[model samples]
Every structure is written in structure tokens, then in C-alpha cells.
Target: MTDFENVMIALPAHGHPFTNLKERSIEIIDHHQERLQTIRDASHQLIEGTVTDYMRVLFSERAWGDMAESETYAHLEHLKESGELTRASNNGIFTYTNTD
Candidate 1:
């Protein structure tokens, strides 16, 4: 079997439904899209920003304000893990996009 197929077979399955998780993810992505646009619009200020810049913007926002830097970062990491968005792979900086 191909390496990709072997890896997929090794992964554990989720016994429960993921509908709520998927819905939450969609909401988070929608919110994230707006936050991303804000950061992009203020791009001039972030011309020299690193991955940290992206995290800072996200953490400071109202939607994610209740979350600590580390916490929000964890959420973003989950998105990357789920193949919803790629992290820190754009312009050598932390940028993201939908899988499509």
C-alpha cells in the first residue's frame, strides 16, 4: 500500500458525531476570515511582522479576547491539524487560507 494509505489506516476513528465540531469550525473560520482581513488591511504595520504578529492580532480581537495567547494559538493549531488552514507557510510569515 502507498505510504498515505498506510498512515490513514493507522489513525483512530471518531466514534461520535462531528456535526457540532464542524459547525463550530465554520463559525471560527468565518470569524477568522474577518480578523485576517483586518490584519491584511493593516498590513503596512505588519510589513515586518513574523508569525507572532498574526497571533497577536488574533488574540487582541474581541472574538478571541477571552483566550490567552497560548490558547488562541492552540485553536489555530487545531485548524492547521484539521487541514482547514495551513499555518506559517505563506511568505515565510504566518498566513492562512481555506483548503479550497
Candidate 2:
């Protein structure tokens, strides 16, 4: 089987496969603060991108193991609701901005 198929097969059947999800989520966000800030400053509003795009950028340099994209999106939503981040959508495309 392909590596992608192997990874999919190895994933947990329920919930995220990683430990300390919330903490890791926060760390991921914090680690990408500079990039996020740059995007926000350049746009003068939200950082234009999908959750998947943001996820890729944020998680690119880190080893997150079997953590699913959906799990990361949910954590980002939680962060948005908690005022740790700001999110807005236009024409069905979402944008994210850092609060700090």
C-alpha cells in the first residue's frame, strides 16, 4: 500500500490520535504567531485562507503524528470562540486573524 494509505489505516477509529491535543494546538498557534501576524498586517484584516491551508502552514515544521485535520480545525474554532483568534468569511472563503 502507499504511504498515504498506510497512514490512513493506522489512524485511530475515534477522536484525535495525538496526546495533549489542546496544549499542542495552542503551541502550534503560538509557534506560527509571526507568520499569522505578517498576514494580518499585510491584509489589514483577516488572514485569507482555509482551515486546511492554515493547518498545513502551522503544522508543517512540527511532527503531529496521527492528529487529524478535523481535530485541528475544531481546536482553531475553540481558539476563535475564546478570542485567541479572529475568523471571518466572505464568499464562502474563510479568513483568520490573530487577536494578539
Candidate 3:
């Protein structure tokens, strides 16, 4: 079963529960944050490059980056489409400049 399924299974059934609603909600949020961090760590390894090059690194270096290739690719595309990633140079390599 999935972690969510496990969480549900472990959740209190009725009046008596392991954690209150607010605590349970916080637990869920924390779980999601950890998962997001894993994905972020994987993507953080990717530097400026063409989409093809990025794919190579994604599979080679970030194979266990905690996200599916399709999902990661979609995110990369979204960044490009959203203007979060900019062209690094004349070669069409994409690089994200951290404004923060």
C-alpha cells in the first residue's frame, strides 16, 4: 500500500484517535514537504543545458532523484514555458538564475 494508504489505515477511526485533526494535517504537510525536497534535490543537480542534455543528467546522475522521469521532464518544460528558466547563451542552453 502507499504511504497515504498507510496513513489512513493508522488514522483513528472514531472519537478516539492517535492525533487530533490539526496534528494529523501537520503530519501530512510534513510528509509532502519531505517528498518535495527529494524531488528538489534531484532537480538541483541539473545545471544549464539543452533539454536533451538535461535528460541525460536526469537519468545518469539523478536516476534515484525520487521523481519519475516523465514528471521531472514535465516540470522542466513548465519552467521553460513559465519563463523561470532563461537561455544561458547562444547555444540555447537553459539556466535558471536565482534572483533570491
Candidate 4:
């Protein structure tokens, strides 16, 4: 079998692995689209808060549940890096806003 096929066979049956970094990043972004949009909407309304605050709001609204805080922050940072959002720090607290 080919090297690619061998690698695929080594992965667990229940495991999902991306072929490359770009693919993995795209999958993560797609999975969090709803949460991303919610943040975007809130940001557009001038709402700015830390990742934990956003998580609490999302959880309370039943829009997201039981996701890791770090993962949420990572996604937010990715959006910021992509220029879809803006991040600022005040007193060591990072807040986010929509770029548009």
C-alpha cells in the first residue's frame, strides 16, 4: 500500500485527521461558524468581553455547551488573525470586536 494509505490505516476508526494544517484549520473554523457569527454580531453591537464572558453568554443561550475555554480562545484568536475580528488588552484582560 502507499505511504498515505498506510498512515490512514494506522489512525483509529473513530479518529478524524486532516491531511494538512490548512485543512485542519478549515475544519475547526467550519465547526465553530455559529459561535463565530454570534460573536461577530455581538461585536458589531459594540459588545466587548473576554473569552470566558463570551463562553458564558453562549452557554446560557444554549448556543454552545461544554466546550473548552482554551479552544474557544484559540478560535477567537484565529478570527482575529484572519482580520475578521479585533482584539485588545486592558489590565491584562483581552476583549474582541468585529473588524467590520
Candidate 5:
């Protein structure tokens, strides 16, 4: 067997339900898209922004207020894990781009 198939066979299957998790991930992605659109609409510009800049807008609107830098970073990481976004860090600064 191939190495990829061996790994898959060895992995545990006791985690969350695949369908439910996929649905939840889609919901989160949709919400994230709406937030991105909000930022674009308010700025009247293209849908591209740095994390700091976007977080400032979110904080000003009191939206996702509980999410400070770390929380926001974690959420972005979750997006990366779900294959909804890509992230990279340069000089300790993280940039995210939506795959869709």
C-alpha cells in the first residue's frame, strides 16, 4: 500500500461527525465572507486587507469584540485548517487570503 493510504488507515475515526463538521465549517465560512464584504462595502474598495486593518474595523463596529489579536489569529488558523483560507507569516505578521 502507498504511504498515504497507510496513514489514513492508521488514523483514528472517533472524532466529530464528518457531515456535521463540514456543515458547521461552511456556516463559519459564510459568516466570514459576510464580514469581509462588510469591510469592503464600508471602505468602498476591493476585498483585500491586512489583519490589523480589518481588526480595527471590526473593533470599531463592536463586532466580534471578544476576539482580540490572539483570538482573531486562532480563528484565522481554524479557517486555514478547514481549507477555507490560506495564511502566511512574515516578520511575525500574518496575512490571510480566502481560497474561494
Candidate 6:
């Protein structure tokens, strides 16, 4: 299944069913942040061009470096929120994959 579908399914399956919504949302944010790092690293390895050719490079590298990790993490979060990025299946070796 797609990562998005996995998240959708796993969330409601979470324990007790009615725990703190805020805390669960934070947990989702944290999950997305980790996914962002993995996706970013993969993109860095597989794609090549000017910095702008990559989505994360729209902002300055140093500026991105300066932001708190959560804020920096939000860059990919917003793309996700806005439906700009997505999960795709791997044709071969990779899992948790995507395309540009």
C-alpha cells in the first residue's frame, strides 16, 4: 500500500481510540519529519542539477540550515499538506519511494 494509505489506516488503529488529539497530531508531525529526511536524502542521491532543481532547495541552504528542525521539516510538510508530493511504488530495490 502507499505510505499515505498506510498512515491513514494506522492512525485510526492507534490505541484507545480517544487519546489526546493534540498529542496524536504531534506524533503524526514527528512521523512526517522523519519521512521527509529519508525522502530528502534519496532525492539528493538520485537527482542532479542546480540547487533549485530540488524542491528543498527553493530556500537558501544556509537559511534552511538555520531554521529549527521542526520549521525546516515543515517545508516538506507544506508540500504534503498542499498535495504537491506523494508516495509511489518502487520499480526495483527501494521502498517508501517517490518521483519528481
Residue-pair clashes per candidate: 0, 0, 0, 0, 0, 0
Pick by TM-score: 3 or 4, better one: 4
**Model 6 / residue 25 / CA error / Å:** 0.7
Best by lDDT: 4
In model 5, which regions exceed 4 Å deviation? 1-48, 61-67
Model 2: pairs clashing at backbone N, Cα or C within 3 Å: none
Clashing pairs in 6: none
On lDDT, who's better, 1 or 2? 2
TM-score of 3: 0.31
Tens-place lDDT digits, model 4, residues 27-94: 65676887777766666655676887767655665545455567678778988999988899989989
**TM-score against native, each model:** 0.35, 0.43, 0.31, 0.57, 0.42, 0.34
Q: How close is candidate 6 to the true structure, as a TM-score?
A: 0.34
Error of 2 at 38 (Å): 15
Give candidate 2's TM-score. Answer: 0.43
Give lDDT tens digits, candidate 2, residues 1-100.
Answer: 1223224223346656654445555666775565544344543333555566655644654744346455556656766787867788878766666776
Task: Report the Cα lDDT for candidate 1.
Answer: 0.52
Score each candidate by Cα lDDT.
0.52, 0.56, 0.49, 0.68, 0.55, 0.46
Q: How does candidate 1 fare on TM-score?
A: 0.35
* Candidate 6 segments exceeding 4 Å error: 1-16, 48-100
Q: Which ten residues in a row have the lowest lDDT in candidate 6?
A: 1-10
Q: Cα-based RMSD of the predictions, in order?
A: 10.5, 11.1, 9.3, 5.8, 9.3, 12.3
Tens digit of lDDT per residue, candidate 1, span 1-100?
A: 1223223222226454333544445676888777645545444455534445556665655544434555545655665687755555565546544443
Q: Which regions of candidate 4 fall more than 4 Å away from where they truly are?
A: 1-29, 60-67
Model 4, residue pairs in steric clash: none
